[model samples]
Target: METPNRQGRRRIVVGITGASGAIYGIRLLRLLRGLDVESHLVMSRSAHLTLNCETELRPADIHALADVVHANGDIGAAIASGSFHADGMIIAPCSIKTLSEIASGVTSSLMSRAADVMLKERRRLVLMVRETPLHAGHLRSMATVTDIGAIVYPPVPAFYARPASLEDMVDYSLGRVLDLFGLEASLAGRWSGVAAKRNPGDAAHVA
Candidate 1:
């Protein structure tokens, strides 16, 4: 990680939606905790269901990982306002529905509302989109957010890490996203590229 967050605490807003890769969001929260970064979490209703279906973690367990938690409907939460300073916001395993809502500036949920705040405040907003085989509309929506300074980071696995387990792949993806925030949350085995397997690849070669 380079350059401490301009603001204090290096606070981050995390949104977990109803996407297949619930583990990405979970792992992100864990990494943030380990890195001692402040995290504000907001989850969609469907995320609860998926959390149960995908992993052993319960709602309380996930909530415990974050320093602050906001309801999906509570648009009035502190994070929803641009006045509330944060390093950035990340929607790990960002569902297509959630992505669309933010892209359209709908702000239908607090998740999107907080993301909207990131955009209007000119703060980084990273969306780890979980879907595959994107269509034209998906691409357009991604382009829309990108046009507005948001990053559409899909959770594609990086094999260079030589992950021996599923968790390794998840951490690798989360680490890459965290790079956008300049946070050192990568799991062991970063590709230095000097050897391409030492300290992890630089951002330019990360893709």
Candidate 2:
């Protein structure tokens, strides 16, 4: 379907790279579908390998979740242009390789190109970098991106939410990331700060 290009409905560019948490990108798309937002998706080749190993969904199934899917090599895609008018871009499970490319302004793939566009345009760029034991180079790249006004959001589980299952954790992360766009996903666990005032036997679940 053609995008409406209508006012009020925001558009977000979603990029999935070769990282451990492809679920973050997938869940983000699912959440976007429920909100008044349009998602344009792009995935690196390594992302496909990771998705196959980490998720049950097939490529087509994954592509179906987004309003538009741009090829990773398609640097000429609409999202590559600053005039595309997207609200922002999110790179959930952003790989170190992709991060480096964007930090260096290499634009090796559509993911990096779109992210570069977002940064140059002074648009919101949130990256859920998925890595552990970050080294000096990783730290430097993160700082570089941050210097350029990109949000280096690592998808750490919020144990304070008292999640019941894996989905709950994933949804909570997605909701919080969506918040960066100033879009609210009500599924996220909110802290009321008055939990102790509740009944001793209360099993208050975060919504």
Candidate 3:
């Protein structure tokens, strides 16, 4: 059975790597806040640049959405240590650069350090690799990370959710990531499977 405090609210770590899809991290923060989950965020330098180019919101605004925001340079922060317990860590829009670093056990930045801690502590680590056209090196890195118990989740939207807008798509993707950590949220449209037949006439015979 899960502990009451642990089930009541999840402590999730959100890391935004140097990838093009900054919206994923931003949408995750918004949804996590709405769900009353405690979120810790770490944004890479390249992620900050992408945020400036892609979204109108500044880093401060994004930081405000999270319960705790840590500098990417702060390697000594509590989050970098395994003693600081958390439900999981999500590296949304994880770039190939960051993925390679984590795969190779390089803890140069706080985001990477937190991921290292998660791996060492046997905590959930979800890497949302956002690159297109994967190469052999990328596949090898993904395999290496998966072998070490890290999940390689690509930002693939589900059409079954019937997403009407970009926000809906973002929510669906982030919701799936949260599901890995056993956190519940209504970010995505609930899956009800295929609709029931309207009538007997709707049924067709196959030859």
Candidate 4:
């Protein structure tokens, strides 16, 4: 796939909700910046708390990474409108509450509202769901969103990439998510299964 074309710049709406993997959202912004993608960021109130709890970076730092920052309560933001020509939207570390809101189309905040716009416009929407041990209700919500063309992607690490650190794992997962939008990031290394298989000393060859 090729990068989206919009006035010679790829525009992506990024959302960060109250999920455990706050770093995913942060790394995603950094990667987008490196790729020269125009990013519109929106973060939930709970996301701020989660960011505070998980990382040392402040809200100012996050806001600086994006081309534009929309307040969570600002449902009137451009991204909340379907007419906005955005390539796609990605919610990294998508909280279950946020996911439920998006699935139900009861978006109370800009984050979910923007996500709803993506669906209504038939644009790509990727949710890096961060919950575990989900109940049936959570599963149902994921299925509903999937049926509506949203990709409910859990940030499952790719062991095939042989990630050496937490940063590597996070970048690889975000890179794969960006792949859904055709946005390439240098952080993720492509999987060379054939090359690994050809190496006699490789772990896969041993098995």
Structural similarity to truth (TM-score) of each candidate:
0.88, 0.90, 0.89, 0.90
Candidate 1 ranges with C-alpha deviation above 4 Å: 1-7, 194-207
lDDT tens per residue, model 4, 35-86: 8889999999999999899999999999999999999998788888877888
Q: Return the TM-score for candidate 1, rounded to 2 decimals.
A: 0.88
lDDT of 1 by residue, 1-207 (tens): 222345556788899999998898888998898988889999999999999999998999999999999999998889888888788899988999988988899878899999998899888999989887889999999999999989999888777678899988888888888878887764666666763354544566655
177 in model 3: Cα distance from truth in Å? 1.2
**lDDT of predicted model 3:** 0.87
Once superposed on the true structure, which residue ranges of model 4 sit more than 4 Å away at CA?
A: 1-7, 194-207
Kindly list the per-residue Cα lDDT of model 3 for residues 72-129, writing each as its tens digit: 9999988999888787789999999999999999779999989988898888899999
Candidate-wise lDDT, in order:
0.87, 0.88, 0.87, 0.88
- State which candidate, 2 or 3, has the greater lDDT: 2
Q: Tens-digit lDDT track for model 2 on 17-126?
A: 98999999988888889995889999889989999999888878989999999999897999999889888899989999999998999877889999999999888999
| Alpha-carbon deviation at 203 in model 4, angstroms | 20
**RMSD (Cα, Å) of model 1:** 7.2
Cα error, candidate 3, residue 67 (Å): 1.1
In model 3, pairs of residues that clash are none
